[model samples]
Target: MADSASRAVFLLQLTDCHLMPEPGQLFRDIDADSQLRLVVDDVLASGLPVDHLLLTGDLVHHGNAEAYRRLLDILAPLPGKRHWIPGNHDEIGAMRAASAMPCGREEVDLGHWRLLLLDSTSYPDGRGSGSLSETELVWLEQRLAQSTERPVLIALHHNPVATDSDWQDEIMLGNAADFTDLVAAAPQVKAVICGHLHQSQARSIGQARFWCSPSTSVQFKPAQADFLLESGGPDASPGYRWYRLYPDGRVESGMRRLAQVAPDPELG
Candidate 1:
């Protein structure tokens, strides 16, 4: 790697693995175990010196302890410190038990940037929607207040902005207005990252951008009035997001989809 690339903090965001209890189990005809393996293989082959691994959410679909254990084993080879948060599908207790990094440790110091991971599984409405508690909201405000000297990147499992899909939007962050209003006031918050949408999309609030990454398991089709999976197309390939945070508070990010994992035509 070039010195410039090496100097910046490189972070990989993998979301919505949705792994089942067993290796062969499939969600929407996409094998989570094998798809995540492909993602890991892709990262290893790329040879980026990932400074940190930010797993946004949906680490496991079944909320089983064994699946979380399996997730750790699959990702053990990838370099750097790992941090995660709870998704609607995740069992927080199970996830914390399977990993050493406490899910409650929200702030990550990345030299010039602050990475904040928030638990968005509270106050669920049973349709996969989640809301932040009054405590967590206050906590986010406190963190944003203190990070004036460093740029901040906040990660949560729910989308804080609309994906334009009615059904999907219905299940997005329930208090997104509250969330985005918080971001709109914090100029130091460079971006807000999230992943329940299972597709790549960006919306802006104040100086920060809200980015939703593609899922390692399966991707839902974007811009639809109704819910639909992206099946058997270029966009359906398993995907992830990468970011390079520079010391100057400049953040450069892009995404790559693993084309090797072809989408199943019957899934839609």
Candidate 2:
């Protein structure tokens, strides 16, 4: 529930952790566990009251039970309800079994705002692209119809629009037109937040805005023709996004990154 006095809901969005079964494992020259720990530490230390933690997707590097256990252990201390969706790298069944917290919730009510969680990884078998089933689209319409007055924010694992990066765009939501068309028709829809691009991107389609957050472990270079990692520069550090949702249907968001890079023992 949002604080009635402030009329604002504070949310933390953490995505693409890519954690491994072992705490010391590395992905793309970045130590996944160490990076995740750094981000989690900063979020808790900020002393900001968060109402919800929206884990967009890619919770693990490999779809394994042990990896989910490690992820859960790292995020144990964070307060608030956590809602998650599956990415290509996640094993849905394994994640549900490993998590003590709720895993896949389609809709959540936060005061006057409603959050819809969609599973874009319809074919979860190492495929980079994503799609929503017919049933999901129908459910989305029903949900939107039911709450036309409340502001809605949708979360999914894949980008619903082009990132201008040819390689990344190819793997984005396959049925983006269908999805966006539905969103465009809904005046109550405020934002669509997503992951899997591994970089921050923002675009506006009609009245709705789409946002993609950077990964907690590594970030990919944006607007590239091919797959590329972001060079270890000041702007390329692992990070998360914070959102402030107001009662009047306004949303404010920003990204936060650690000043120090996660220690990569393998590089040493």
Candidate 3:
């Protein structure tokens, strides 16, 4: 049986990689592949015994099969049980075909906590906005019901709550109210971790804490009225979130960025 004894489970969240099939291809003027390499290297060097790596989404820029395959190649050496979900920019079919990693699962049991991965991508309309279908909602509720005794950490692609950036808020989860209502009802839920804003943010709503991890490639500027990209300088380095989930239902988390990564000259 999975043990939730005295030890803490180390998990890492890497989001918005935006990598392309080509090695030097740039997304928003940032060399996504290089940045991802740097981020992966940093995580390895950190000496953190990461038990699981939660990839929150936007793994690739164009949703290409080759891109996903390339990403798998790049992250092949990372030591953890890697799981990913789809982002607005990702093609679900391609991602699934390219990797053996499960995309959306009802729950992933980690010793003391249950990690739920949700699909927030809205199809046909093809906008940035997200939605939880009726079926997904039912699935979520069922999972929550079954895992009442375990602390739950939900992972989705888009932020379910407002990030204060008007443009980003518009693109966030369309059914966030419904989503949060379920979360609020489930006392076992400890946190909701996500990506898509490309910037880091943490906020508490009722019992659940919501956290947005910075992108592994380029980051978007926060709290802006309109769409704005982070300046490619010291202020906007690529980063990931580190999570330490304790056996007693407590979570310790923080963001870590590459120390000396310079912003792309063109983006600057």
Best by lDDT: 1
How close is every model to the real structure, measured as TM-score? 0.92, 0.92, 0.92
Candidate 2, residue 183: lDDT? 94
lDDT of 2 by residue, 14-133 (tens): 999988767777787778888888888898887757889989888987657878888877888898788889887878888878876555547998987999999887754345997887
lDDT of each: 0.84, 0.82, 0.83
Candidate 3 segments whose C-alpha is farther than 4 A from its true place: 1-4, 123-125, 260-268
Residues 1-268, model 1: lDDT tens digits: 5465337898889999999877898888878898899899998997877989989888898567788999999999999898998899888888877877777438988877899889888899999999888889999999889959889988999998887899999999989888888888888888888989999886676678667789998889998988899878768888888887888777777787887432222111
* Candidate 1 residue runs with Cα over 4 Å from true position: 1-6, 260-268
Poorest lDDT segment (10 consecutive residues) of candidate 3: 259-268
Q: What is the TM-score ranking, best to worst?
A: 1, 3, 2
Better model by lDDT: candidate 1 vs candidate 3: 1
Q: Give all candidate RMSDs, comma-separated.
A: 4.7, 5.8, 5.1
Off by over 4 Å in 2: 1-6, 100-102, 124-127, 260-268
- Over all chains combined, what TM-score does candidate 1 have? 0.92
Ranking by lDDT: 1, 3, 2
